[model samples]
Target: MPKEIAGPEVTPGARETQLGEWRIVALKDASFALDGGAMFGVVPRVMWERLTKVNSDHTVPLATTPYLLDNGTYRVLIEPGMGLRWGEKQTAMFHISHDEGHELVTSLRAAGVEPEEITHCLMSHCHWDHIGAACGADGLPVFPKAQHWCPQSERDAALHPDHLRRASYRKEDLQPIIEANLLQTFEGETEILPGLKMVELGGHSDGISLVILETAEGKAAFWADIVPTSNHVHLPFIMAYDMNAALSWEVRTKWIPLAAEEGWLNLLYHDLDQPMGRFVVDAKKRYTFAAI
Candidate 1:
């Protein structure tokens, strides 16, 4: 939404797709902006600016997306976008926009899936953008019936935030879930539910984890911040936003090649263009993205 910046328009409602034995709905939430410099990390702007557009303020628009994995039994929602609770100042800072196609709640309703129908809300971490929507304007669980799943390490980090985290881990965003005592946390690689598993890959955050699922074609991974967007499909494109650029690089090196080799279903949450794709290795072993 937020006016596609030279990308195909995604339908407002959810579309059904098959991933082996699983049903997937790649949900759109909102379009927000971030500093282009931070997004590109050490990459020189002279190079990256050519690859993507930037606003007058040097901020780039990013997609806030969540993925729904349903196997008829479990309704799992991953990466619920920034909640609809931002004030004018915060909105201005983040440049959050609400195009009909990207409004989180409306998109969910339009998809014919009500909030109460979500059985599990698996969070990649407690980063404001990732966990903000677990609760809503009323400060109650938006998906009232869903159990909020996250990494215990992330919850602990959010609870005892340091200077580096103070800005990223917003207390107001997470208070409701904590007050409701609904948080269900896992340690490392955990199968929080049937057919759904997650493993911590600390790059974006201290406890940032990627969600994995069983797809019809092969294994699917939601590598969270490891590969936030399609642009990052290029191996060297790390973001300055990552807490551990080294760790992110290390993880990308390990997981990306496997994703390409094994034909894993890859989900890019922050990619404004396409959300689902597979990694392909060219004759020279260069990675490229092929949308599903």
Candidate 2:
């Protein structure tokens, strides 16, 4: 059994929803503020600022949200929010600010789970925010009993990074996990569990993946960074941080239409307002993120 850790009080809308065979719970952790221009990619600030409140510095607040998938037998955690390992300089650089007691581990505790109780830590990519909470300050896997899964391509990139965007992969995040022998890497669509599988949707990162599973209603998909926020459900709303902008747009246009048609409870990673919602196609054939 794992030791209990207290989490910050749950805010409104932080509850569980039943999806066929599984139950999904949305949990919020830390937040980081980033420039709106960078977040909106090619989209003009004038347009995005209108949709979201933009600060004088042209920055927008992003929520680092995680999800807990409970099927009564297993508990799988997707993308534990940015860990609380930043020093003064890093804190200032990333504009990292967390709620009172809502760090990743604490958020899990808030959900009545301990770190060791997590059976799977499915990472979408090796981005710091996505993998930070996997390791502790002393460089050890936080979820000692869980099977930590990472894409082989992402592991290679993080270990041997190139010049561009190298800072995004933090050593503290990967080194500890590797040392603990809890890390498992895979290629293509892999079935970590019977109903849960990771689909390669590489646009944001070379090896980023989207975790999808069958639900009683339809299907639930964690599209990862391809659609970080519900607002990014729009075809062109991609982040400039994507390594391949063309691929991002291509993938989004292709799969999102299918998602809307089939009705997926999309769990977003960075949407401050809405965490998970369904998509509906209007008469214009445009996919809109409908709050459920």
**What's the lDDT for all of these models?**
0.79, 0.80
- Residue lDDT tens for model 1, 1-292: 1111122222323244667666777787878999999999999999889878799999988887888887778778888888788899989988998776777778887767888899888889888888787878787789878888888889887888999888888777667887887778888888877667888878889889989886445678887778887778778889999898888889888888878777677788887777777777677766767664
The best candidate by lDDT is 2
Give one digit per residue, the lDDT tens place, for model 2 in 67-163. Answer: 8998878999998778778899978766788766658777778878888888998998999888887877666788898888889999988888898
Indicate which candidate wins on TM-score.
Answer: 2
List residue ranges in candidate 1 displaced over 4 A: 1-16
- Stretches > 4 Å off in candidate 2: 1-15
TM-score of 1: 0.91
Candidate 1 displacement at residue 276 in angstroms: 0.9
